[model samples]
Target: MKGALREALQRARVDKVPVALVTQLEGGAQNLVYSSDQSNAEISLGSSQLEEIRDMLRVARSGMLPGDEFFVRSYVPPYRLLIVGAVHIAQALSVMAAQCDYQVTVIDPRRAFATAERFQGVELCAEWPDEAMARLLPDAQTAVVTLAHDPKIDDPALIAALGSGAFYIGALGSRRTHGKRLERLTDLGLEDQLQRINAPIGLKLGGRGHAEIAVSILAQLIQARYGG
Candidate 1:
């Protein structure tokens, strides 16, 4: 890595901008491609290949050809898992998310259950969901989940997360429960954004335990991340 490329990568990381590096095989000429719509990039890579590079950056993957002159390396933002609950499922999900190399934050207004003793080795925000999410600011690399059965807390957080660039938004509820939630959101003028949410919040794993449910949710999150 040259000094310029290293500095550009550092800037992109600090600014939370998704960028891709294309390096020429012969002269080692390098170019940085940002994923922001406002950036009208004028690089040697064709418009079609640049679009593909953007998708590769979204999934945090590198693209290389077998006998091509250039290779693309993605510099995406870090993966974040924001859980708007402090329940048993959140405890299990937090641990699993950490294992999968996600920066996990658990937010809940109930300080009693959101204590450090319960959620060990994870970031805890005892503030209300809206306040905590305001500070957290879910981005394109983030996955937001609401495991708090209380709609008062989960709904507000969902509204905030849905408005942000978080790649995944999920809620833990049955179909009937989700329907009620949807009605509430619709009444709040969030009907247009409802399709972005993944309710019932997990793969059909046919198990009801906290750990099992955590596994299913994490599986769905992986599918969201990798587009599987």
Candidate 2:
């Protein structure tokens, strides 16, 4: 691999971007392609061959495309979880999400609560929900959840998330709470966007406690990702 190719691979890893390497069948000429931005390293190939590789790259974004040097090798980005609130359920959910291969990030304005001790292996952001969410920029490969149950924190995060390509947006609240939440969001001019939120988040698993709730939430997230 050339220095440029190595650097591009490293950038993809560090930035969590999906990329692909296409190699010529005869001379082993190589090209680097990014699935996120569709940027590519220099390589000589026919437009027809290039389009085929691009189609493969698109399919690879969901998972990895099978087979090797026959044509193209792809690397896909890991899915991400942007969780608002560092509460107990968040801690449990973060752990579960990590086991499910999600790059978990927990955001909370209360620095004392969003501590490294509680969320050991997860990323912690000690900023307001909206500020942190804006920096994160949840995409199609991301899941956003508001577990805080506080309007001041969760609502702002929702504003940023709903406007993004986040695959799943869930909030922790009941029917009554969601009703009140909709009213507040309507006042903020988000009435049309209310349906995007999966209020009363998590599946009806007939379980209680933080751990059970976390399991239910993860189950619903899996269902959303894989589809029914």
Candidate 3:
């Protein structure tokens, strides 16, 4: 509630950085702990307490530590889903992602497929995949999925997502298709980053329908987010 702490929290929110506000229950003293390199000089925490705070930050959970002497309130950036190539699978995925509290955005250069009528209540970007990814600057809290299936669209977005800190990167493709895609990406000098992509995007749910595929993708994405 102090001016300095308030400003730090505001900055963290703006920068999409995860942090925890730790308040001592007895003395009412407070310290801010960031999940990354940013730190608060006002108070120094022991390694054990720092690790506990980090665990809370990872799960975005707020609660008292083991001793109940301090309460940690987690403040994490909103989870985001950026779907490249606003196609049929994207329509379903967007809806599902929104239901799971993701701020969903569908991007495509083709205006016809990225229309609001089709992707109701979802953010639609009418720019090319690379352009949109560059502007969005996908962060650790963001997930990028390529459902466009077109190399021209999916490849650029994959390249951008691979280069970013986006936590999840998935592409819809068959095993054979993914092999070809991998070759193409390798040719583009992305061999090292290829492992980060969930190529046959989604769990092996054995569901072939668009909605079922969406479910599988969401399941895998949640697993990735939770380190499952």
Candidate 4:
């Protein structure tokens, strides 16, 4: 039974289909197996890289077999996120963004701030702004945030985001700062792209602390993405 189940799983993996190997023992029967076709997968599961429903189905069907292991291999998507900063605000924002179905990635040229210690669960990239951005081939679903205040970094990423159809494009800066940044961006032939930016990013909750500000920013981002 175990061997048969593994074969089905292998076939499903190769075809890029999701399945659950539900097992059962009926009276004297050792094992009975069922499968949930990938097309019929019911739950969205909030981007958790696993087919937990399948695992649950398997356990329910095949009660407790000492050597039986029913688990779902992690399911990964092609989506990604790119954040440009290693500041306090960036740290907080990354945490929340990660929870919201994003494959979070943070980039910064400052080695001191961009460390495994600061970005606990993020994929940190400490390379020059333009050089780092060149590595990302964002699609329409990608989200790009320019949390770095430095023009050298923020400006480059902003330009790139404007060019791409990234679902969300936000920048961290004050009204004055954004105004000046806008002028500079216009100078770079992005005059018509001004409408694409969510400058002075985040809703007006009127808070200044690092964490609170991060909350406001991510809140707005969620609304935009989920149609809330």
Candidate 5:
């Protein structure tokens, strides 16, 4: 029985999705504790557990709720941010996004700029725009940013982003530049998506340069992602 329990836990951890491990511990107030994180799921003979613990865990495996923490922690997934450019704005936004609980990732084919020396502590990927984006397509909790104004970099990145479930899709640009860019996107059969993007990106802050502009950009992005 112990060996089977261990095998089942190993498989659950290998699957990498959250699971509630319910177990009864011997004669203690905390006997009914259930573990949501696999790291804390361990059972030792002398360590003490109720005999019926395995059955409780079996019920949980069938998708039964075990406890409050099990429902709250295991069910909530991490928020993800995929920045499609390792530019200066990305440099600033990455830090801000991390502070706001986003798992930030940066993708740019330029090895020089994408290196750890520049992006330090961020998921920097030196891959082609669309291909790099394919691996990080947005979900309900995802937000995307295209900091590079260059079409070779920004266009394809935005194309892949707009086609996904990303809650927020922003491209840095001025209103006039947005007009010209829109014409090009429409010519390329991306007008519908062009409308979907938060272009002339950022709120009406009337700011310039990298950092402050990034602040405005992030403000607008978060608002679009979470606001009504």
Candidate 6:
């Protein structure tokens, strides 16, 4: 790799940007393709090829093109899970998410709940949800879940997630609770984005335990991630 390309790849990795390196099989020509930006290419590609590269980037797949003339290798950022509450459910969810290759971060203002002993090996943020969300800047590779069950914490986090490109946003609440939550968000002028939130979060797997709920949430999250 040349110095410029190597530097760009390093920068992309640090910024958690999804990028692809397209190499011509014959001449070894190369191009760097970004998910949402212009490409840095020494070789030209048609619109269809660019679209195909984007599809591969979305799924983080690397493969040869139709004609076998070029190969695209994708470098996708690690999937991130930002939990807005450090509750019992979060403990199970964090462990499950980590096992499933998600970089999990649990955020809570309550020091007692966001303790390291409770959530071993998980990133804990003792800041308010909104503050933490602002700093995190959730993106397309990120999933945000609000399990706090408190409007003061969950609402702000939901608002932040709704405004971001986070692939999934879920809130733990009943139908009635979600209705009230919607009213509050609507009053805050987020009616249009409310559909993005999966309230009463998790699949209805007929389980009520914390671990079961975590399983359902993780299942739903995987489904959303792959467009299933």
lDDT of each: 0.88, 0.83, 0.91, 0.71, 0.68, 0.93
lDDT of 6 by residue, 1-228 (tens): 567887898899899888999999898888889986645578899989999999999899999989999999999888999999899999999999999999999999999999999999999999998899989999989999999999999999999999999999999999999999999999999999999999789988989999999999999999999889
Residue 194's C-alpha lDDT in candidate 3? 96
What TM-score does candidate 4 reach? Answer: 0.68
State the lDDT at 140 in candidate 5: 64
Over 1-228, each residue of candidate 5 has an lDDT whose tens digit, in order, gives: 266555655565565433444443332111122342233334332223332333344333333234422221122235788888788888988988888878899988888778798888998888888988887667767888887777888888888887888888888777887788788788878877777788877887877778888888788877876574
lDDT of 2 by residue, 1-228 (tens): 677777878888788666778765556666776643444445665566556667776656322224443357777778899999999999999999999999999999988889999999889998898889878899988999999889899999999998999989999999999999889888989888889899799999988899999999999999988786
Error of 1 at 225 (Å): 2.7
Q: Once superposed on the true structure, which residue ranges of model 6 sit more than 4 Å away at CA?
A: 1-15, 23-51
Q: Choose the strongest candidate by lDDT.
A: 6
Clashes of each: 0, 0, 0, 2, 1, 0
Best-to-worst ranking by lDDT: 6, 3, 1, 2, 4, 5
lDDT of 5 at 144: 84
Tell me the tens digit of each residue's lDDT in model 4 across 50-116.
Answer: 3344454433222343334322333224346788988999898888878877788899999998999
Superposed model 1: Cα runs more than 4 Å off = 7-11, 26-55, 65-67
Backbone clashes in model 1: 0
The superposed Cα distance between candidate 2 and the true structure at residue 167, in angstroms, equals 1.4
List runs of model 3 lying over 4 Å from the truth: 1-17, 23-51
Alpha carbon lDDT at 146, candidate 6: 97
Q: Per-candidate TM vs. native?
A: 0.80, 0.80, 0.83, 0.68, 0.68, 0.82
lDDT score of model 1? 0.88
Better of 2 and 5 by lDDT: 2
